[model samples]
Target: MDLDAYVAAHLAEWRRLDELSRRRRLSGPESDELVERYQQVATHLSVVRTSAPDATLVAYLSTLLARARNRATGARTGTWRGVQRFFVDRFPGALYRLRWWWVGTLAANVVVTGVMIAWLLGHPAVEQSLLSPAEVDQLVSHDFEDYYSEYAASHFAAQVWVNNAWVAALCIALGVLGLPVIWLLFQNVANLAIIGSIMIRHDHGAHFFGLILPHGLLELTAVFVAGGTGLKLFWSWVEPGELTRTQSLAREGRTAGTIALGLIAVLLVSGIIEAFVTPSPLPTWARVSIGLIAEAVFFAYVFVLGRSAFGRGQTGDLDAALLEDRVATQA
Candidate 1:
């Protein structure tokens, strides 16, 4: 078909495509297809328009080509804006609504800790069964008191902080795989259970509390935050709310990522305390006081500070609309 004639005929469809592209609600494959189609049509039109013998005809074709290009550009820009809005504005709002999940996760942590304490009171042999020979040897020979004293003396707090922060980040990041987060939570809980059991078995459970509680509060809370991050992603896969499973997962994934990053910072501070301050042979009262303070700080951050720090506020049903738009656009 002649270039000018084809452009005239397909102008309406091209305009529609341009509008859709600008909206950027389309999937990657759909957007790519639309861009390809636009490029192909433009190329063909360009050839026909340039070959026109009449100057007026050539000028008219050029104008049409410019319009098509402008529309395509506008569509691309709109799509980017939509995506930014989804990430920066929409996702955090959705996370804020999921406050119940965070509370449940914290409750779960307390339950797990209580279970460990109960198991320690009930079973003594289970501790030995759970630990490998090497771990037992390390526990016995390490003189944790002296080791922690030396750690407090050394300026290695920053290094400990970085290492733990990385672990928390990894736990959250890998949680995106769904099952990995479950595995992480199980491993962490099991380790704590065994450690608590072993300490009590040795008649040092009270002593262990004195030694570990100072920092354990922060460290364990950070773990819970990491678990919460993983849980959010896993829930997205399991229950996508108003969105299809895939769409929900994608939307939740972005919010989960931000939560994971914040968890990392919490873990880092916890690690510094655990490494340098917790294991020392501090008096029971001192340890208890520190642990209580740490717990208070953690609660404050999770409940009061997090909302502002994360920029959470009422999104007024925007998330639902976004999901609907995504589904409709995909269809």
Candidate 2:
């Protein structure tokens, strides 16, 4: 048969195979066979369209590609069940082999936090240098309890939430450049130092715990996740192992994207508390309790609940098949 006819006969099969692949039910051998067939058919059809420029062939292939793309996107965002399966079941097993990423990120956070604490203890002027006069004034003059209460009531809460969300997103997105990870680490460390210094300078060292602990825990954790993601990207470039830098980066990017999404959720919660809940006229004990609870929830989601919600055993076999098929199709 001619290329056009051959392509026409297989297009329906490709669509059907794509659908089955997404359902996470295909076995490994069957998946590999389908992927091979899909790639062969797609390549031959692509060449045929390129050589003859038949409008019918072009339209058919275009529609097929578009459908495949939509299916992939839908699989990612279609429902809570799918998303949970993807994260818990599919991602962890595929990506958790990169243990160095966890180690490097933890080490970076420790170094940065320690340096910031040391600087605050030794250099009082550094705080004023880092913070603007207005920021310093606001930190000093406002009763944090009252300020937090007012912030919670105002539109400021939404703004802070959106802003922090964007920051977390940017940290992950910009990791594509590699240097942004270092910049993020330094920026966060400097901010921590400035805040620590300001509190100590005002003789509110003890009060600082009540002021920041509520939201700071989650907010800082989100920042750390972002930093880790960026470091992973950079590490791919520095140590590509068997893969090319480009390939390594792409692999790491997929995992980092997942981490970034989880962090965005954390930032949203942190922003709510920082803007509205943290600053309430609640007692110190109440604030401490709430903060501890929030921190516990965040950790539980990341380490415990997140595992159960999105574990590898749930979707690994099917996801691996689909991923292989997609890769083959692209090739």
Candidate 3:
């Protein structure tokens, strides 16, 4: 292609489109001309990109296209329909894409928690080092159970929700540091292990499981997802693949934002169970069943629904068509 001659031939039309796009009012013919020229300039952009690859030309066409598109579509806010699209397409798709990462995080936590429990159980001295006989007996006997009931259910739910959400937020907010995520996960697992070991050592293992399982399943899953997504964000900077570092981080960070919001709902469910369900007088089987059902629904939401959304080309990021000159950002 003779780039100079092509630009010479098309400059007048491009200017006309630019002028019509900039003008406050356009006659019907001019309006029609805007759309027609928009398409023509768009086609020229594609051809130039393939054949001549001029940065300035592509950017000009991209901006022109964007203005025309916005003018055509008009401005919109968070309408009900937009909110519905976000949850259905973006939120779940983000969670599903990051499933393997968080699943691995879940597995690692389980191993660490189990190991800590086994070690604590085996080493009686370790328990003694932390708590005296009287304290240990009190914990196993009443205090642990009482901790859940001492406050009103609603109050306790709010407290638990805030605390758990804070932990999840930390895992995400400090993801760029990477090590903070590991530390947060370790601290959470360590605390759980310590409490579990104390409960088991005093032969209240069954009671502990009965009390915890009703809420722990979904609660811990949310935490794992946060941590996993955070670590993935860190990895984005480390290994950006084909994207520039900034682009990769931008993409993953946006996705992480989706996970963060989705997990709020997930954590809310667990919080409700922890407050009302876990401490209920209902049968242990019934309580645990509720937890299991909630957990199953979450998994299905991410995998089944999220997979379908992803397959439909939902990447949980801003629409590429809405972006200006996406190709210009290429590394």
Of candidates 3 and 2, the better by lDDT: 3
Model 1, 1-331: lDDT tens per residue?
4646866776675665555546536677776766565554455445544454456644543454455445445554478786565445543454455567656776886788678878666875665576776776567446545556664444566666676677667666786676776677777777677666666666677766777678777776666666676677777778788878987777667666656555555666666666656765666788678777877876754445545534655331333322322332231
Candidate 2 per-residue C-alpha lDDT over 228-259 given as tens digits, one digit per residue, 9 for 90 to 100: 67766777778999987876776777777666
lDDT of 2: 0.64
True lDDT of residue 2, candidate 3: 98
Regions of candidate 2 where Cα sits further than 4 Å from its true position = 1-77, 83-107, 125-138, 143-147, 150-154, 306-318, 321-325, 329-331
- TM-score versus the correct structure, for each prediction: 0.60, 0.71, 0.80
Give the C-alpha miss distance for residue 310 in model 1, angstroms. 8.3
Order of quality (TM-score): 3, 2, 1
Assess candidate 1 and give its TM-score to the true structure: 0.60
TM-score of 2: 0.71
Ranking of predictions according to lDDT = 3, 2, 1
* lDDT of candidates 1 onward, in order: 0.61, 0.64, 0.86
lDDT of 2 at 48: 55
